[model samples]
Target: MSGRETGATAYLLREPAAGDVEGFAELHVRVWREAYRGLMADEVVDALSVETFRPIWSSIARAHAEGAVVDDGRAMLVAVLGEEPVGFVMVGPARDEDAPAPRQVWSLNVAPEHQGSGVAQRLLDEAFGDGPGYLWVAQRNSRAIRFYERNGFALDGTQAQDRHDGVTELRMVRPD
Candidate 1:
């Protein structure tokens, strides 16, 4: 495991309820700051706020409950401990114009404390599954890249600058 593992504990996986937005948003900021410490400018990462993501999570939850997940290969699941989300995974139709696969892993994040407790893998499997897909990982994000590799993704000589943070990202694809 790339991140530290405390002994495993009981955790729940489920669809994100509207009430989970605050916790999920906080988790998003925490995971990004922890995971991208050296890879992104501190100011850029620090500027991220839970307020910015609350509506995003709310909309996602509402969409899911409305049965909007039937098409587009979209799915998301959160790993929770009590009322807080320890980790989450989101997948959907690939957004790139020349995407390698129809499916894309939009995001997979776990709090630093929960990193190696298998919560990440559980969320990933519950959302992304074994189907063909692709994802972009920051070039120097070795831990995430390795995890993706272990799950059957491999670099495909493609690169792009992240629109938000300007980080270089490499494309990895899992073929059908």
Candidate 2:
């Protein structure tokens, strides 16, 4: 019982089964490694594994399987080019108390080779639907910041630092 799809790729957005968990986890790791290398700490990047993505995807899959749908709801969208997953965008209601209601992009990642092919943009278009959206990006991730900016997201001047991880993040938002 996942959210409804809006385009020709509806079938690609199907509810993920328990078995799909592994592929989802693998995609997360692969895309992160391919997309974030050099942008993030090599140690942190190398330390990420399927184990880290497992719980994250498992929770999303479970929620998509059981959560109630809302008006302007949000969900995860994985884009597969042929049989291989090339990108994924996790979107939903803005959880940040500082953000406007409606849609938020918790994360968006595309394989380095597959980027600029509209995979990420298509996923965002489907999930956010021209609505107001917000996302947090690591401050050091200049590439992502540019991407977000190019997509119309503006810096909202919010910042936070992870005490344990020491990563700095900036909040960006877009009006509907």
Candidate 3:
């Protein structure tokens, strides 16, 4: 789906292609640095590098292209404006043993310039579909928490520290 956003031509959300790996990696690092700036340590944010994630994104794209990801309901959707990727979402079956829902939103991000342009909403709708699901968000990311709440997710009182960086995260669930 696509439309004009603000004044720019809006983005189109579609399954990621192998050629999109580099773009996805770059966007992932950019969004994480911006979104987690004040909520996480500078060192941690600075450590985010596209080179560090390119291989992983490439593997996922390869799996997706080979039709090996659908059985697990895993997918990576990219939102492209013109020829550049402005955002992406990764989702799949929940990994937590105690999760209330079977699906989990592993990541959802939009370029700061694209915020409030319905890109995130479209991504969420496509990722979660019409089913119960959950996601973990940084506890201090009030903007994201509010966005999830507005989209039908509510905090389920579950919290944990990210193993790699020790940042606290809270679980939110949408049971519909």
Output the number of the TM-score-best candidate: 3
Residue 96 displacement in candidate 3 (angstroms): 0.4
Q: Report the C-alpha displacement of residue 64, candidate 1, in angstroms.
A: 2.8
Model 3 residue 66 distance off true place after TM-score fit, in angstroms: 2.0
Alpha carbon lDDT of each predicted model: 0.84, 0.72, 0.86
Evaluate residue 5 in candidate 2 and report its C-alpha lDDT on the 0 to 100 scale: 38
For model 2, state the Cα shift of residue 103 in Å.
Answer: 2.9
TM value for model 1? 0.90
Q: Pairs clashing in candidate 1? A: none
Judge candidate 2 against the unseen true structure and give its global Cα lDDT, from 0 to 1.
0.72
Local lDDT at 105 for model 3: 96
In candidate 1, stretches whose alpha carbon ends up further than 4 angstroms from where it belongs are 1-7
TM-score of each prediction: 0.90, 0.79, 0.92
Q: Write the per-residue lDDT of candidate 2 for residues 36-150, one digit (tens) a residue.
A: 6776778988998999989987877776667643445667677765456666777777786667645688888877766766667777777666767788888878878888888
